[model samples]
Target: MRSRSAPPTVRDVAARAGVSPGTVSKALNGTGQLRAATRDRVAAAAEELGFRPNHLAKSLLEGRTYTVGILTSDSFGRFTTPVMVGIEDALGAGRMSTLLCDGRGDPLRERHYVQELLNRRVDGLVVTGRRPDPRPSLGRLPIPVVYVLVQSDDPEDLSLTYDDVQGAALATEHLVASGRKRFAHVSGPERHWSTQRRREGVGRALEAADLPLAPELVLLGQWSEAWGRTAAAQLLRRDSGVDAVVCGSDQIARGVADGLREAGADVPGRVAVVGFDNWDVMVEAARPPLTTVDPNLTALGQHAATRLMDAIDGKELPRGVHRQPCDLVVRQSSV
Candidate 1:
């Protein structure tokens, strides 16, 4: 019997299983056609001996590293954490390893990390960022690249991101269906793509109900609770008759709720409120739990990983920006 400390080699496994070294290789690596009985015997032998294949040699033979790289611009990891969990879960099942690099929104750092990942011979890469805007493409590279959350400017590149327009529309429709009319919108910086898309969504939905968003009712400001609170006072001053308010982010929604409550207005009674980004911290901690839109970022990450795997397997990458749908989470605030 071999010593327990030393691992069993393919030769030893072959000897025990009554097969040649080449046949053992074929069985373990899944390289050639073999009888069911023979494969079973080899597998059984391997299990008993705790024989693990040498991945280094196997990579050389197959010309594949079985490794993937994940590059993210979200240094704080607020958005990247959930996405990474999904990517790891999907890639781990395929016995692929992952390497992560943070660009922290720096061009020089991003370029450096990209070069380093390429030097490591990764089979594919997944690119992610917190921004919802479309960025300039990374340009053609040696391996397949999948973009998550942030879209690539190139329509041909496979970019998976949440559908901001649809999510906003969903929120507005819910409020409209609740019999609340005379709507007002509060959002982040005017230049943000998410802000534009969400505003368009609310406008379209309201227009469908024959209540188009007017110029004075649309409030564009920084994404902050203070701004939301200030906007609330502004809305009351501008249009006290407005019954429903849709905001671009949960933080802003929470602030609006506070402002309305502080102004002696009953929430959901005098003014119903809705928010985007179903962030638990902001939504749950609010005076009344917020009704918000969930971007479903984890699912987006999983899809990106699967696409990278497919591309590595010699399949052509599907062209275009794929918009993943967001889900609406209802709470006391909207009711």
Candidate 2:
């Protein structure tokens, strides 16, 4: 029934509620001191009038756009997608929108996107994946920046990353409890945080069991099936005594199992295999199923969003590297 010539505004809402525009603003922004009953009246009237605030005008007055920027590497990666979904859901609940920028592992492209987001006046920023160190000057930006699934050079910067250390520990401990003592590791890139944490976790478990890892038993390479094949081949050829294998990822574990089968090794009979990143699609179809750790990336993303919102709300957050817990799923591969 309303005319299309002019859309409803704060003034319209105020007029409908029998209050001043200032009172309407206070109730909507939750800033100025306003009685709860009066605020409810203003909100109800605004809803009835179908009044949506002029975001640009409100931002101009408050010097904030209430927008958050999310920077991700390889936006289509399986692991990154769930985390992003969590961020989106949390931000939406907070009544904020996100601008996503995919770096695709390009430093120059990342820098450009950061600059663009800043120019658009995003109130906060969240960067994902391992990036070339953010420019030292990024600290000077007026908005808060948080890192997810990656480590940043700035110690003070907020980061929520996968607890790879705990993930590795759980995998290794499971193998040990399954009565497999002789162990080997098929690892990813040496410089990767995941690879490093996994290695450390394995070592801790071994140390706790009063066992020492043989240098030849540790196979370090990339997060690829090809590397898994090569590492599995060499490991079996050199030491046929290994009773278990801990793979850096589900992909790597698949290749390792394939190679072991070709070499006539009885999976879970003579050797148990455990991997990281349950990576459900590939894992569900893997032969003999895979015992792997679930990084809980979705939960990690949600946590990051919650943390960022807390910071925005001026709430005291216990700041440090927060590592989300990982779950070890049992399956045929390690049975």
The best candidate in terms of lDDT:
1
lDDT of 1 at 76: 78
**Residue 309 error, candidate 1, Å:** 0.5
Cα displacement (angstroms), candidate 2, residue 104, comes to 3.5
The digit string of per-residue lDDT tens for model 1 on 44-77 reads: 9999989999999889988999999998999878
Candidate 2 regions with alpha-carbon error over 4 angstroms: 1-54, 130-137, 316-320
Residue 36 lDDT (model 1): 86
Which pairs of residues collide in candidate 2?
A: none
Over 4 Å off in model 1, which ranges? 1-4, 11-48
Model 2, residue 331: displacement in angstroms?
1.9
Local lDDT at 252 for model 2: 92
RMSD in Å for candidate 2, one decimal?
A: 3.5
Q: Go through the candidates in order and give the clash count of each.
A: 0, 0
Could you tell me how far off, in angstroms, the CA of residue 245 lies in candidate 1 after the best superposition? 1.1
